[model samples]
Target chain A: MNYISASPALLPARAGVGFKPEHFGAIAADQQPLGFFEVHAENYMGAGGVPHAQLRFLRERYALSLHGVGLSIGSPEPLDRDHLARLRRLCALYQPESFSEHLAWSSHGGVYFNDLLPLPYTEETLAVVAAHVDETQTALGRRILIENPATYVRFSQSDIPETEFLTELTQRTGCGLLLDLNNVFVSARNHGESALGYLASFPLIAVGEIHLAGFFDASEAGAPLLIDSHGAQVADEVISLFEWTIEQAGPLPTLIEWDNDVPDWPLLLAEAMKAQDRLRHAERGYARRLDRRAL
Target chain B: MTSVMSGVAGDFAAALRDPLVTPPAMLSAHAAPAASTRFCVYRNNVAVSLIGALEARFPATRRLVGDEFFRAMARLYIKAQPPRSPLMMRYGDELPGFIARFEPAAEIVYLADIARLEAARTRAYHAADAEPLELSSLAALDPENFARLRLAPHPSLEIVESAFPIVTIWASCTGEAPLTAVEDWRCETALVARPRLEVEVRRAPPGAAAFLEALARGMSFGEAADSAAARAKDFDLALIIASLIGGGLLVPADGVKQMETIHGYLA
Candidate 1:
């Protein structure tokens, strides 16, 4: 399927937030419209309940994105058909505008670790990830946005840079990218690399959505290491990096994620509102650039 | 090719679960195995997140045992048996059984039952939605044929019977009741179901679980009532049925299935 043109129309180039059940009342009653709301697909995988009821209500109001956290897309083992089938069923039920999963695996040796475990970025690993993406896209009959992972370790066998690996996967599977700017900042800081340099090399045009979130500070062997905790407010550094990304990518569908210590609606909304301010600035800049080109 | 990839992935997986296992030789930071502490990030994430999933599902159990004790217990459980699938909402399905056999938890006789009750609530919350069987349908049934009617159990209904006062313990710890000593040591039965948006965990009298179980097995009302009466000498059929209706614990029939002759209906 031609994923880019598929409707309820692509997610608007505005700010969005990850859906938290606690914020359902506020989100449903709010007067201001959001660009979209992203939900972890696995949370609503059960047959029926309030999760679905709430999602259904939200679907009627705003664009929806089904984010898959358990596809285990980087596994060497065959793709889990049962999981793919569940995703298909969910898509049929909700008809979400977008679907995305991580560029990491969670299951191995017949066990799901429940963490987005990192993998080697080599040709062998690349083939495995590409095949998984192919199977998912074919199974769901829609292009998926594969998010760059927040990693603490890199493989010695990985000859490919993270950007090139992601770009190749998009090329092979016709998948789009979901650039998580906070993840970029986290991974870069952890690995002693420049976040700006990583984004400079990244294939920005293929990015369909963006994520910004908070990280906890930690260290390894007395060197600074950051954990993608997603349990707190977006860091000032991450927000700055996000602003830079919008300056280049020009107001994509950005999301504010606070999954763990999720604040009250007002606090979370303020985070999205902050991203919206930056996105609105980028939107106007793009408009002015268009007028200049016409002149 | 697949086996080699699996071997590589297996080593990575093993290291994440076991702090003892050496970090995989192929993994590093700045191109050296010196980043084993960095490797601990993935390890820590897996352990903390899985334990967090369990704690969320078993809040009452966590409360009965303080947060520290529960987490330490959960960590041991995770190490012994990590989740086999990614359907994490119900990941700790075997936790109750594990706690039952666990040596440390042996003295807390009711801890395992609390886990089971909490697990049942998780199931009830996610179970398929259904409407309550209307009272009018029961009222309209022919007197002779009513006893022969087979009611479908609501998908979310779960009956947990225990020798310990699990209902009181759960209610007290989960904010429905203030913490109080349970002076009366006795058996308890909890009817856990989400007939509507909210999951209701109600205490039931003796023989209620058996009655509901019999009904759930597709037995006729007469048979279920007989089973309940046999189990509990003082079983009141009216009271149990009233509780069932009040909780919307049975799926509403299709406008009440048309009944045949009395003998035919019983058959």
Candidate 2:
């Protein structure tokens, strides 16, 4: 099932803010050249209210994407049918340009843990995640994007590399990857690997979107630990890694996520501007490469 | 594969409920060095995030009980009552009821009510929207018919009557204050309403609480008046009607055709 917008959003490589209620009035009253606004699908789960009212007003002018944080896609349990139904309803109502979820589980047993928990990249877990993704795609009757998660620790029993696991997921389910370069940098640093290597190995052909967000460096002793908190500006190193990804994957619809202690709209847009610059640079580079090939 | 997934889900539930089951690994015999640590990270994240949800939803309660005891109680409550919905904002709706029966906080008798007020405020903040009736509609009605007409409160209106002075405690705890001492000897009533988009809570008068409570149940003006009278025979209908309308409680009755030139001797 391929999800395509009837009138697709013109996601220019420009700055955008995480659509929040705090900035609703500011966005509504002001005329800012924001690229697009992103919202968490679950936050607007309610039937009708001020949030919906605000979103309805904003949707007319802004290109919207529904990013989900707690779908528990990698859980071994059966997908929550009702939750998926609500998601489908949201998709039907908004007709958002893009939708994505993390390649992590937040629930075990019948209880939800609320945080995106990591999963071991064994064949067994891969098969489990693939089935869930298949079911989710079938339920929504549309293709969705999967994001890689940042982990504080790695499992010794895992067999496949994270990139290989993600590639296999896309190959089996035909869903695209919403690669977060920050998460790659975060997970690689914590687990002792090269972010560049991870970027090189990523299945660029299956990449649908890119995410650039801030991370916290919880480095202790001599080791530098990167935590994907999404609570600050995009780090310089992460941007460098993101540039490498764009050099490989070209210009994809990228997002700037700042969920905690969120700054004012202008500040967020400034950070997004930085991403837009990198994307434009990548696009120009791609154009030059094509021109050189013709010559 | 489905069966294996189900088995994992079962183990995951056990890991959250039974703290003794530390690692969430599928097989114990093949446990890796990273498995235990990763599982611990997952456990800590779950415990902390869920507890944070509870704290955000029930800040007054947390303030009352302090941090250490609050975290301990939150952990126990989370295991017993994991959220039934994916909507994180609605996660801790049952915390008030849980706090009421919580053995550790049994000594703080008012803690449960404070939690209830906080939860009510949260619900009111997210309740469905409705257009309020114009105040002129009420003024046009003849005072005699005011008692007979039905009054419809806003959908988000909630009246909570508690034995504890929850409003004063919540106000003090939320604001910087030379803390007003609540004479915990008497019961207090708090009325919550979303006049605009935000929820507002105010202390309700003795008879006013009864009047609004009855009206919230879809009672006619007369019935609500009688109910209020039963609670306090000296309940002044005029005062309540004026106050309720001023607070955006009643809406105009449909097809209330005004009679032009009532009993005019000569037009």
Candidate 3:
């Protein structure tokens, strides 16, 4: 079904906040200019009721992006066809502007973990993820954006770097990327790599959206361990990386994701405003670079 | 599947389920110790997230048992009954049964029933939408034919009957009724339905539970009333009918052909 229009112009290249049911009343009552709202597709997979009611109201006002965390797109096993069908039904109902899933897998052997479990990046895993993405896009009848995962451990047998794997997957499947800057920072810190170096190696041209979320920092065995907890404010360092990303990729559809310990509407909106400010700054810089090229 | 990837996924899944297991052997050794700690982070995330889903699904159960006890029990439940699907809203379907068999919670026998009621409420909240039968529509029916009328229950309707006073317990836990005020220790039934946006959980009237349950099973109104009257001594047909209509429990029978009884009356 032609749920959403074929044009890739639904969401504006500005900042939006993640939609939480707690903030539904406030969002409905307020007249804020938001770029779009993103929600976990699994949360609204219910048969019908308050979720659909709230989503219908929001979809009328703002563009929506369905960010799925449980597709198990990178699972070694084949993708769950039933789950994909439900996702397609949801997309048809909402006609969301963009639909995305993580690079991580959450299900295996008929048991779902409810957490985005990591996968080893290899030629074998790459083919698995590419096929899943291809199937998802075909099933939904729309292109999808696959987000990078925040990893805790790297596989010893893996030969490919995450950036290269993601690049190749996009190339093979024609999928876009949802560059979650907080994940980059968290994964890099946990693995003792430079976030900036990772960003530099990232294929910015294929980035269709960006995500900024908070991480919990802990020290384990005297080494920095960053958890992608999404429980706090976006770190200044992660925001800097976001700014760098915007400078390189121009103003993409940025989102402020606060999933756990979600604060009231105002605090979440303020975070989105922070992202909006960065986008504005990046927009000005892009215009200036264009003028410099003209000169 | 590549042996390396399959091996890593299997080991990772095992370690996430049981922390005592060593970190996946496939993890790079460059940050071996840190990777183990990081692996623990994933383990913690899996446990915490699943526990959170359960806590959200069964808030009353959690409140009945303190947070600490609930978390410990939930962790065990999560490990034993991991989700078969990725939908978190549907995660705790087995919790009610699990609680019934849980030894530590055996003292509170009514806990499982309360969890069942909560699950029913969740199901009702997410059930399909349908326009309820308007009371005005019933005015056209002949009074003599009312007994033979067949009415349908809304898709969101659920009646949870329990031997213990689950409605009282649920109400007390949700602050609808004071705990001290719940002195009646009799069996109770809860009527869960979402007539509008909010899911309403109310104590089912004396015979209304049986009446609604029968209607849900496609029984004729006369038969359902008979079932209710058989169950409750003070079954008032008029009062139960009013309650069902006013509560938005009844909908017009759809798809089922109206049948003619032996008396040549349309049912």
Native contacts recovered, each model:
0.64, 0.34, 0.70
Q: What is the per-residue lDDT of model 1 for residues A1-295, given as tens digits with 9 covering 90 to 100?
A: 3344322226888889999999888877875557889999999977567997899898998988899999999889888888888888888878998899999999987789888988888888998888889889888998889999999888777789999999888778778999998899999988889999999989888888999999998764557788998988889988888878878877899998889888999988898998898899988987888899899
Interface RMSD of 2: 12.9
Selected candidate, larger DockQ, 2 vs 3: 3
lDDT of 1 at B112: 96
When candidate 1 is compared with the true two-chain complex, its DockQ is: 0.43
lDDT of 3 by residue, B66-157 (tens): 99999999988988899999887788988999999999999998999999999888888877766777788778878667777778877788
Off by over 4 Å in 2: A2-10, A25-29, A47-50, A122-124, A154-157, A222-224, A293-295, B1-13, B16-19, B25-35, B144-148, B176-178, B183-185, B208-213, B251-267
Report the lDDT tens digits of candidate 1 across residue range B150-239.
Answer: 776677888888999999999999999888898877888888998888988988866787887887777887888898899987798778
DockQ of candidates 1 onward, in order?
A: 0.43, 0.24, 0.45
- Global Cα lDDT for candidate 3: 0.84
Q: What class would a CAPRI assessor give candidate 1's docking?
A: acceptable
Clashing pairs in 3: none
Q: Rank the candidates by TM-score, best first.
A: 3, 1, 2
- Report lDDT (Cα) of residue B25, candidate 3: 73
TM-scores of chain B, in order: 0.89, 0.84, 0.89
Worst 10 residues of 3 chain B by lDDT: B258-267
Cα-based lDDT for every prediction: 0.84, 0.75, 0.84
What is the RMSD, in Å, between candidate 2 and the native fold over all Cα?
6.9
TM-score of model 3, chain A? 0.96
